[model samples]
Target: MAMRGVSHVEVFVRDKVSAVRHLRSSLGFAHVADCVEVDRSSALLRRGEVQVVATSGWATRAFIARNGEGVAGFAVTCDDVPAAEGAARALGAEVSALPRGRVTVTGIGDVAHTLLPADGHDPGAPPAGRRWVPRDGAWPAAGGAWALERVELRLPVALRERYPAFLSRVFGLERHPAQRSWLYSAPAGVTFALEEQRAPVPLEPPARAAAGSPPAASVTAYGLAFRALPAPVLR
Candidate 1:
C-alpha cells in the first residue's frame, strides 16, 4: 500500500462549536472551515501538519451517546486509493466504501481508516452543506510550536502482537523495538504505539462532585502525543 500517512483525524463530539473552541483555545489550532447540515455540524481545525474534524449531529450524538466524545476515525493519504483498499481487504480487514470515492477500513476497536487520494485535497475540508466562512491562508507549516509526534493505542494485552502485525501487513508500517510497548513508524513520520492494558483505564480520575462536571471518558483505543517546540527567537 502506498500509504503517505495520516491525513487527518475525525473526532465525534456533542457540540461542534464547543469542541472546536476548545481545540482552538487549548491546542492552538486554527479554525479553517465549517459544514452545517440539517442533521449535523462539523468544523475543521489545523495546527502544524495535524488536521482534526470535530463533528456533532444526529449521528454524532448517537456515537457520543454510546462511546462518549473521542476520536472516531482517521484518514490516511494514499497514492492509489483503490489499490490500498484492495490490499487492506486482502488482509481480512473489514472494508467499506464511503461517498466521494473514499474507503474505510475498520481497525482495532471502533477506530477506522478512511483512505483518500494523495492529490492534496484536504481530507478535513468541509463536506457539502451550508458552508461557514472559511479562513483564508495556507496552513501553518509542520514543526510549529506544538506538533503531533506520536499516537498511542491502548488495547487488550492479547492484541499487543496481532494488532501490530495487522498494521504492518495492511499499511506497510515498520515495527520498531520499544521497551514496554509496540511501536510502528509510518512513512510520513508518525509513530504509532500499542500499549498493553489488562483492564480498561480512564484518561483521568473522576471529576470531583463539587466541580459539577462529569468524569472524563475512559481511555479510548488511542491517545495523541504532541511535542512543544521552542519559541522562535527574533533577532
Candidate 2:
C-alpha cells in the first residue's frame, strides 16, 4: 500500500521565541501552539502546508548537540509495517526489536517510527509533515514533482554504513545503488530519500525562556521548493 504524504518535520530548537520569530518573520511561519509540560517546553509553528515542530526536551538536547543544528527527524505514514519492514531488511537495514506500548519500529538511518493505531491521533494534534500549514489560511498548495524530498544528513562519514543500516531497520528503507543512497516509497507514490551532505555543521545551544528550562534552538531546517508556492503568503 502507499504511504501517506509527509505529516510534518520535527526540529529540536534552542529558543522558542527566536525559533518562532525566525519562522514567522524570516520564513513566514505562523505560531500554532505554545506551552510547557512538567519538564519539557515546546512551541508549534506552520508555513504553507508544512508543520515545523520545535521542542525543548531534556533528552533531546544530546541529539541536537551531537548531530549539529539541522533537520533532526522525519515521519511517514505507511499502510503496512510488516511488509515495509521486510523490504527494508532485504536492503541491508539493521532491524531492532519493537518497543513495548509505543508500537515503535526502529531501524538504522537513525530513524525511528511509531504506528498510529486504527482509532487515530487526537483531533487538533499535529501530524509529522503536515505541521507547516496554519490553522487558518489559503490551505496547502497542490501537486509537486516529488511529494517529498530531504537534504541528507552529514554524519561523521565514518558512520555512513552504520547510518544507512539504521535507517533500513527503523523505517524499512532500501538503498538505491543507482542513487548511491537509500529510498522508500509510500502507497501513494510519495517517496523519501536519505542523502549525504557535503559538510556537517556544529550544533548550537537552544534558546530558553529562563534559567533551568528546556533549550529552544532548532537543529536546522531544509528548504522545500513546492512545485508552486502560494502568492498571498503561502504558510
Candidate 3:
C-alpha cells in the first residue's frame, strides 16, 4: 500500500447534535463545514492539525444503532486509492469502493476504514479559531484551551493483543511497544494506540468497571488525548 499516514478519523456519534458542541468548546475543535466529503455531509471538527468527521441526524442515529457510535471509521492517505485497495486485497482484507476518492478496507474489528489521496494536512489552508456556525444561526462557544494530540483505541483484552499485529500487517505501522499500551506509528506521523477495553488500567480502579464489558463504542468515547494548556492564575 502507498500509505502516507492517517488523513482523518470518522467518529460516529450517538449524539451528533451535542457531540459537535462538546468537541468545539470542551475540546478546542472548530466545527468547520468547509471541505468536500464522501458519502455524506459530515460534521467536520478540526483543531490545530487534527480533524474528525461525524455524520448527523438520521445517518448518525443509524450508525450508532449498528456500531454504538465511536470511531467507526478512519481514512489513510495513500498514493492512489485504487492501488491501496489492491494492496488491502493482497493482505487478505475486504475492500469496497466508495464514491469520491475513498475506498473502504475491512477486517479490523467492526471498524470500517477507507483509503484517501495522499494530500497534505490542510489542503485548503482553512484558518484556525474560526467558529463553526449552524444553519439555524446559532454558534457553539469555545472554552477549552487544549488541542487533540493522539487517539487511543480501546479494544477487548483478546482483541487488544492481536490488533497491533493486524494494523502492522495492513497499514505497515511500526509497532512501538509500551508498558501498557501498544503504539503503532503511522507513516503520516500520528499514532494509533491500543488499550485494554477494561477500566483504564493505568488510573481508574477496577470497581469502576464491570467484570466483562463488550467491545463497543458505548463504553469508550473517542475524544482527544489532550495536552493541557497553561492555566491562568486567579487574582
On the 0 to 100 scale, the lDDT of residue 158 in model 2 is 60
TM-score of each: 0.67, 0.57, 0.61
Score candidate 3 by TM-score against the native.
0.61
Per-residue C-alpha lDDT of model 2 across residues 1-235, encoded as one tens digit per residue: 2344455555665555666676665445667755566655666665545555666667456656655444565555455556555655666655443432123444444444444322243323465322334444443442222223443454555666766665555445565555675455433233344445444364343333456765323223432322223245558
What C-alpha lDDT, on a 0 to 100 scale, does residue 179 get in candidate 3? 38
Clashes of 2: 48
- Identify the runs in model 3 with alpha carbons over 4 angstroms from their true place: 34-42, 56-69, 80-84, 99-101, 119-122, 125-148, 156-158, 179-181, 196-221, 226-235
Which candidate gets the maximum lDDT versus the true structure?
A: 1
Candidate 2, superposed: residue stretches over 4 Å from native: 85-102, 107-111, 115-125, 128-148, 154-159, 165-179, 182-235
lDDT of 3: 0.57
Backbone-clash count (model 3): 0
Model 3: ten consecutive residues of lowest lDDT: 200-209
Q: After superposition, how far is residue 54 of candidate 1 from its true place, in Å?
A: 1.7
Top candidate when judged by TM-score against the true structure: 1
lDDT of 1 at 95: 89
If ranked by lDDT, best first, what sequence of candidates would result? 1, 3, 2
